[model samples]
Target chain A: MGSAPHAAAPLLEFHDLTVAYGGKPVLWNVDLTIAEPCLFGVIGPNGAGKSSLLKAALGLVPIVAGSVRFLGLPLDQVRGRIGYVPQRETVDWDFPVNVMDVVLMGTYGRLGWFRRPGRQDRDFARECLDRVGLADLAGRQIGRLSGGQQQRVFLARALAQRAEIYLLDEPMAGVDVRSQEQIFRVLAELEAGGSLVVVVHHDLRTAAEWFDRVALVDRRLVAAGPTAAVLTPENLRRTYAGQLDVLDEIGRAVAARGRTP
Target chain B: MTAPWLSAMTAPNTLVAAGGVAAVGFAAGVVGSLALLRKRPLVGDAAAHATLAGVAGGFLATGRRDLPTLLAGAFVAALAALGVLVLIRRFTRTRDDAATGIVIGVSFGLGIALVSGLPRWGLAGSGGLEQFLLGHAAAITGRDAAVLAGVSLAAVLVVAAAVKEITLVAFDAAFAAAGGWPVDWIDALVAALVAAMVVAGLPAVGAVLVTALVVIPPVAARLWTDRVAAMLMLAGLFGLVAAVVGTLVSATRPGLATGPLVVLSAATIFAVSLVVVPRRRQEGS
Candidate 1:
């Protein structure tokens, strides 16, 4: 909850991080750090472990080596101050929960187990719903909403969490143009409010325009820093065209056998 | 109402049994709603099928045919089956559906073998072990009904207390885990509650078909509502109605197995709901 000590330590830091699936490494040793609140993007080719970076940082997946620290502390000690929005496709949209119900989940982490959300929580959820331009659809079934609206609902849920940092995975993958703009605007507002917003995005064109800082990853850290500095043609080629053959072959072999490569 | 119908409804023993079955039905629907939302309805089927083995083992180990002892054994077996399912999923490349099928087929087969062998083995007082195969509510005494009702009530309370957490985990496990909620533990809790309801239902619905008591009502209720809370309430109501109807109908017919009657009644309600509810939702939307 406290600000980074003396503003010297990075707000979020990943050191020598490695991740594997079924004992086969997918993400190799990588190191990265974010020192302040900004619109940060993790951009990579498909299957380049972009999503896995977020998952490993949030502890959704195993970290084979190294550590992720938030404000110089372990994730467990600072989880409540962190909000996460997983990929839109990670959940079943047909689940029997309304828009409000899904958004209310953002409050569950802070409310802890067995404690119901109170009037203030409901009001806050409504406020978040309004932020995503879906306040009127609060009672609608999630499945009935369009893809853009569904993605916004997830954003609203993360907003209700009221965290100091946010990690969003593929929030704009299937989103329409207008919804994409709207999502970016809300994320910009979050950053304006002095919260760190880290987005795992796929579109390179949008990444160039949207992010103040970006990290290009292809199984490992290719380049990172200011978007203009790190998103150069050379860095882009290394990230996209320079996919490691050994990693690719091992990944395919592991996937074919349903084991970790 | 007919005279016999009135008498059947008013009879003390029948009323007690009906009340107990109603509790089981309500709890099953409530717990099963979570399981259904989690997209693991068949997990209950595996647990239910495995309960037969436990019932037989309970009788053999405790040398008693009481509801508590048999159900205790049944619960243990149900958990064991779930554990096996988890192991198979974690250790093997077999898909979830195939693993579930393996557990269901193998455990149920072992159960049938044990129950069928009990009588031939000439174990004293093992004559009624086969009752658990298809279920006979007439065999449940008032004491047994009370115990069943107690377990059902407890299960319902557990669901109510943790509805928010359970729903979060079911809907988005990755988000829940990132938020520091113990997703695996919540899932296990839901599974355990389902196992409890399955065992509670064994006296009336039996191992082979008890899963119907848990699954059908929740699926039917889903057709009627978009909200989790409403779906849970409607599912419980639907389950209660089915349990009561099945119990009473089976009471009137002496030789009918309560399991089939209960399942048939639930399926009928599900059919009706499927026909009636979605149309209304479509019109409203």
Candidate 2:
């Protein structure tokens, strides 16, 4: 595995990771490695466990087996260096917090417990909102924003973390074209600034255009490499339609028997 | 001459009780905001109902009717109910709502049975324990009122200190967890705060309806503001008004329990906010 002489450990590594919900594995033993800072994408169809992959890595969900490492260390050791943008629908938009309040959450991890955000944090959060083109709407109630604007607010929040590695789950799923372009551009800039941005996206066409490297997933890792190499017609078929019934049956059996089927 | 009812409202003991109850109301609103935003409003209900068992058990075990001992018992019961709710949700296939309902119904029933049976069994001094069922604020002494006020103040301070952490967890738990915040511990702190508020409220609002003290004001405040800090302040103010007004009004009536009046007062504010605050614009045009 060290044959590539003196290659620094991947920016993130998932070695034989298996994630489950209620004893049912959603992501199978998946070995994925992000060797460098890039705009990476995890593309899959509905129910393909794309989001679960990120959840497992972040310790949001229980991983039945395997380990996740960030910068050659466990997640707990480098949590401050990572940022996460959860799906827009995962939260109640009507929650009584403004756009700035939500974005300021990005700085909470760095501030640690019982510490309020200082002026420096606020300025950085405002700069992040500016990057996402929502500076003018910083005081608006998050629920009052458009779907695209809400998505951008989440992006801005993630950017406020000032993280070296960003993981976004479905940031553009319901976003308008203009907001999608804005989000992609910011992500591209993050990559240029030497931060690894891993996005869980489903749109195939845009996946081809946006990601520098992509992983095709369907309950398991199908193909992973440069976007051009991983999104071939055969890989797409395998990701969207290949061995699904068989995989489902095996997953159920494995869950029932408490072992891989 | 002032009316007899008006004179009753200004009695020294009654005024002291009202002040303490007001503190409880404010604290409940603040802590309850986090629970409401976290979408765990019913957790307070479960904890509130379970407090009855603790109140009765405290008297039974210690043979003392001190406010602190009774409330300490109630806090224990509330935490136990929450623990049972978590266990049921985790170990069994019971849905979240169903689990909460089970804890509420069963624990409250147990509490009611114990409270009722204690007096019938001729347990001396157990007669007044039933006042905790619907709350009788007039029964509170000046020292007990002071204790309630002090605890309420501490709870509010705790919420103030951890406002950012609580708000982050409430708004987006997954993101908070990913950001390496101790999500479970934060959630547990919120729950414990809710339990504390519930216990603090029991002397004024009663076990059966105490959750209202924690829920109604924050919800009403939500209608009037879009910012969390503003909502919290508004909720606290609304709660204080409801508690003070309810206590004073109940003082006027000879046979009134304070819990229903406090809840009704809060509900009235919520109804007014519903009519007064403009509707928020729907997204996406």
Candidate 3:
């Protein structure tokens, strides 16, 4: 698959993508193309399928029926090329690990099973941590870091993957203003380096100011385009001001799926 | 190897008790770490109490209290409670809190009934069986405690082998999945570990409240440190302290049920953490 040597390929392509938690679909008809590298935002109200989109796109969540291609191939075909930074609260801060250890996980995908992370892997992790301004704190316990620093550690782990596409789920959620700026700066640098960065965000203010393009989602794709076009009053009202019947239905569907047949 | 001190004042019993209790502490620390880190530290309380019915039933059926055979019954009972919990979550409109409460209240009542009624049924050797409800560790023979110690030790070993994988999965399941770690299996392994510890702890803490060993230590340790490893080690130390102190305390006081005594020791540890430790920063700024 790697031998195709197509550098100009679209980074991500989604066709009629639908994702469900139990049997209830959370994301529907998610047709989009992330061709050129850009700072992208996925915005929606609480319980909207914004987080679902990022997870499904990255193959973290289950897809009901759809096609998601990365660089003209399937997820397994280009696993190493994709990086994911889940929510800041996804990990247990009390885990018996340091920043360096968590960052090393980014290299695990490439190293495969039964292979210990060697010096080269360590060096890449260190460099990634350094880039995220966490080099000095590598040896410190992960739980001790501030929220922003914790988020950066996740980013550093993603960077350690040396991936071409990054899917960050609410990296700025609950973060201080300086951390938000710092996180956005890293993404901007990553975008400038020709990497696709898709972020799931709840804050509309940050979405309006930071993203180059935004997808306004609530159970379905309401609108997706350049930030200015997607975050208009109409779209914002459609996302937050609506009854959220669709999301309620989706949540029920999700709950039903976990039941035994 | 058999402990060789039976000739002394307490014979091999005291050595076995000390060594076995220490192992239990270490195991509790390790097992409790995952539960505590998951932020569901006291989740097993209901299941732990429910195991009493199963323990009594096992003795009634096979007419034996051999540690292994008895534990098999408690394991089944614990799994049954977990299954019931899942059902409540699915079928009833009852929230997780109410469901947990129902299970905790009803199951323990059933267990208490079975324990209290066993002797009236004219069952042989049922007099001492009630101790499991409110433990009497002196009721546990050296062999029984050894078996308990061995099981806890084996569980600690399994946790050690899978340390990296469990830490990765617990800390961030999605990232672990993306990295090709089998997040599901890790979760199963953790459940298995917790269940096994619960079963093993029944002999010392008894089926009525073994979950305390699984929760209290990790919580006490949390107030002392931030890192996962330190928390785990400290939890183990705390559990050991609880187990040893509880056992010794019961040893001193006649008619004090070791189970309640043990849980009280852990409760004391938890109180110390709550009062002496710094308060947590509230979630919303």
Which is the leading candidate under lDDT? 1
**Native-referenced DockQ of model 3:** 0.40
Query: Number of backbone collisions per candidate, in order?
Result: 1, 0, 8
- Candidate 1, after superposition: displacement of residue B41 in Å? 0.2
When summed lDDT is taken over every stretch of 10 residues in candidate 1 chain A, the lowest stretch is: A252-261
Off by over 4 Å in 1: A1-7, A244-261, B1-10, B280-285
Model 1 agreement with the true structure over B1-285: per-residue lDDT tens digits: 578867765678888898899999999999999999999999899999999999999988999888899999999999999999999999999999999999999999999999999899988788778789888887878998999899999999999999999999899999989999888899999999999999999999999899998899999998888889999999999999999888988887568888999999999999998788758573434
Give the alpha carbon lDDT tens digit for every residue of A1-261 in model 2: 524324487899999988888877788889999989999999998988999999999999998888998888789888999988899999988888889999999888878888888999999999999999999998887878999999999999988888999999999998999999999999999999999999999899888989989999988899999999888999898888856684777577666668535
Return the interface RMSD of the candidates, in order shown, one decimal each.
2.0, 2.2, 4.1
Q: Give the per-residue lDDT of model 1 (tens digit) for A3-47.
A: 545556778999989888876877877899999999999999998
Q: How close to the true structure is residue B270 of candidate 1, measured as C-alpha lDDT?
A: 94
Docking level of model 1: medium
Evaluated on CA atoms against the true complex, candidate 1 attains a DockQ of 0.67
Docking class of 3: acceptable
**Which model is ahead, 1 or 2, in terms of TM-score?**
2
DockQ leaderboard ranking: 2, 1, 3
Q: DockQ for all models, in order?
A: 0.67, 0.69, 0.40
What would the per-residue lDDT of candidate 3 be over residues B19-83, giving only the tens digit for each residue? 67667867987788887676556556766877888888788788887767777888778778767
Chain A only: TM-score per candidate: 0.92, 0.94, 0.89
